[model samples]
Target: MRMSELSRRSGVSVPTIKYYLREGLLPAGRQLSATQAEYDENHLRRLRLIRALIGVRGLSVSTTREVLGALAEDTADTHRLLGLTLGAIQVAGETEPDSPEPAEVDALIEKLGWNVHGSAPARATLAETLASLRTLGSPLDWRVLLPYARLAEQTAVLDLDQLEGIEDPLEVAERALLLTVLLEPALMALRRMAQENESARRHADGTAD
Candidate 1:
């Protein structure tokens, strides 16, 4: 496809496509002339992935570039590929990088037998959230999280199920990114609705908090 066709198919303007090419977010097309190039399905897929990562997920251009770079490195292991793509996503809570690692967090992970990396962003997020709770005078027991962790484990299965049979690395990454980020609000809404239902069921009135 020509640049114009690529632009038409991608829903991106011609100038913006050129800008992506220059920024290294989108790969260069095959040279057709001194001033023209031809693109293909791979480019289209990658272009869409770039748009999702930047536009929908709100990743900066530099971060998007790093993600694209990670995608370029050939990896036969699907797990590693998924990890690379997932690492691009920054989970909401980020405390100081130099903050002390909480031992309770490690103990909780051990209790759950979760094979999470020490450097995982969610680890820091959990630690920070737990710390904040203590600072706010509602210190929670690490054991209290066990039930939620079990539920999260089940939920994680459902989350990974969304990626099944997605062969394209970019497509897998894009789907995972959208599902993980977009579903957060939906999950919160579900929790609120469930709480109301459960309250009414148990208390015979929704007014009982």
Candidate 2:
């Protein structure tokens, strides 16, 4: 297909597609003539994957590049690549204007017995979140996150189980991308439903009191 057809099919603008081609996110099309090029199904699939990574996953260009590289590797370890991608998107907490100092973060890492690599963005994110929690007068403790972490681990296992026996690498990668993009909202809604049921049970018990 020509550029205009590709633009219509992929729902990506021509200039944006050109930018992606230039940035090496999307591969260059075949030169059919002096001023015309042609794209194929592979290009269409790649463009959609790039859109999902950037638009739905909210990954920065550099991070998305790293992820795409992993996906492209013949011997790439999917689990490890997913871990790194998730780490990049992890929300440590929130930050306040008068947030705690980096030194305080160092101290907290020590206090929590966390053996993090020396001074990284992850550490900074944690520090900022802790500071924000404090500013909001919320109880901030490592123990509080334990249950949530356990649930997250279980969910990861569930996601992997769902993906088991996918021999096709491209299909596996696409499924993984879609799962990550869609699962959070699904989990959140499930939690809300559970909360409502529990609240109803509590109200019934209170009425009996």
Candidate 3:
């Protein structure tokens, strides 16, 4: 397809596609002529993935470029590919690095027998959240997280199960990113609704503490 056709099919503006080409966010199509380039299905797929990551998931251009770089690496191992994607998605936070919180998180993961890597971004997020809880004087014991961990494990199974029929590595990467960034807000909203329902069931009758 020509640049016009590519832009039309991708639902992205021609100028934007040119910008992506220049920014190295989108790879250049085949050079059919000095003034013309031909794109293909892969280009279209990549364009959609770029739109989803940037428009829907709100990733910065650099982060999206890094994610695309990881996806382009020749790796069929889904887990490793997921690790690469996740590593790129870690936005900076207010918490300082290299704290004792990681050690406590490690012990809790050991107790739960989770297969989470020590260097996973989620591990750092968990550690930071726990540290904040302590700073706020409402620290939760490790035992209190057991049920939540089990629930998260079940959700993880569901997440991986959704990728079963997807064979394309790029599609898998896009799905993984969407599940984490796009669907997460929905999941959190559901959790809030569930909490409200539980509160009503337990405390609405005036016998609650």
Candidate 4:
């Protein structure tokens, strides 16, 4: 496909596509002539991923470039690839943010026997959230979250199962990002429905799990 076709199919403007090409976010198309080039399926897939990274995730060009670098790496470590992509979504850096709940959060993760990185942004966010809950007069600690953590373990298994058997890193990363971020709203609604159902069941039986 031509760049114009890529632009049309991707809903990205031609100038923006060219800009991505120049910024290394999008790879160059095959040189057909002095002023013409042809793109293919890989390019189209990457274009969509770039759009998602910028439009949905709001990553800056440089950050998107870094993620694309991870995708293009020669290693077969899908774990590391997914980590970088998901970590970007969490706005993580090399270190956790300074907060009062750091130790508590670390202990909680250790108790759960999860292998999450120390610098994961979710860790810091959990710490900050605990403090906020205390300020709001509803202090819930990690012990209270233990059961929910077990549920989360199952949910994580289900989530990763969707990506099983994929070989294309670009496609895998794109699917992971879209599914994780885009499904959150629906996932929350499903949770609400389940909560209501469970409440009714417990009340009707006069017993709880």
What are the per-residue Cα lDDT tens digits for candidate 4 across 113-197? 9999877888877777787777688978778988888998998898899999988888788888988888878889999988988
- TM of each candidate vs. truth: 0.89, 0.66, 0.88, 0.86
Least well predicted 10-residue stretch by lDDT in candidate 3:
91-100
Which sections of candidate 4 miss by over 4 Å? Answer: 92-100, 199-209
Query: Going through the candidates in order, what is the number of backbone clashes in each?
Result: 0, 0, 0, 0
Off-target runs (Cα >4 Å) in candidate 1 are 91-101, 204-209
Clashes of 1: 0
C-alpha RMSD of candidate 1: 2.9
lDDT of 2 at 195: 84
- The Cα RMSD of model 4 versus the native structure comes to 4.0
State the TM-score for model 2: 0.66
* Best-to-worst ranking by lDDT: 4, 1, 3, 2
| Residue range 1-209, candidate 1, lDDT tens digits | 99899889988889988999999888899998999898999999898888888888898899989888877894466777777777657674755555443677888899999998888777877888987887788877778888999999999999999989988877887788788778988999999999889979888865655
Off by over 4 Å in 3: 92-100, 205-209
Which candidate achieves the best TM-score against the true structure?
A: 1
Best of the candidates, lDDT: 4
Cα lDDT tens digits, model 2, 96-209, are 556554556666556555556663556768677667677678846655655665676688789888779986555566667788779878989999978877887877553322
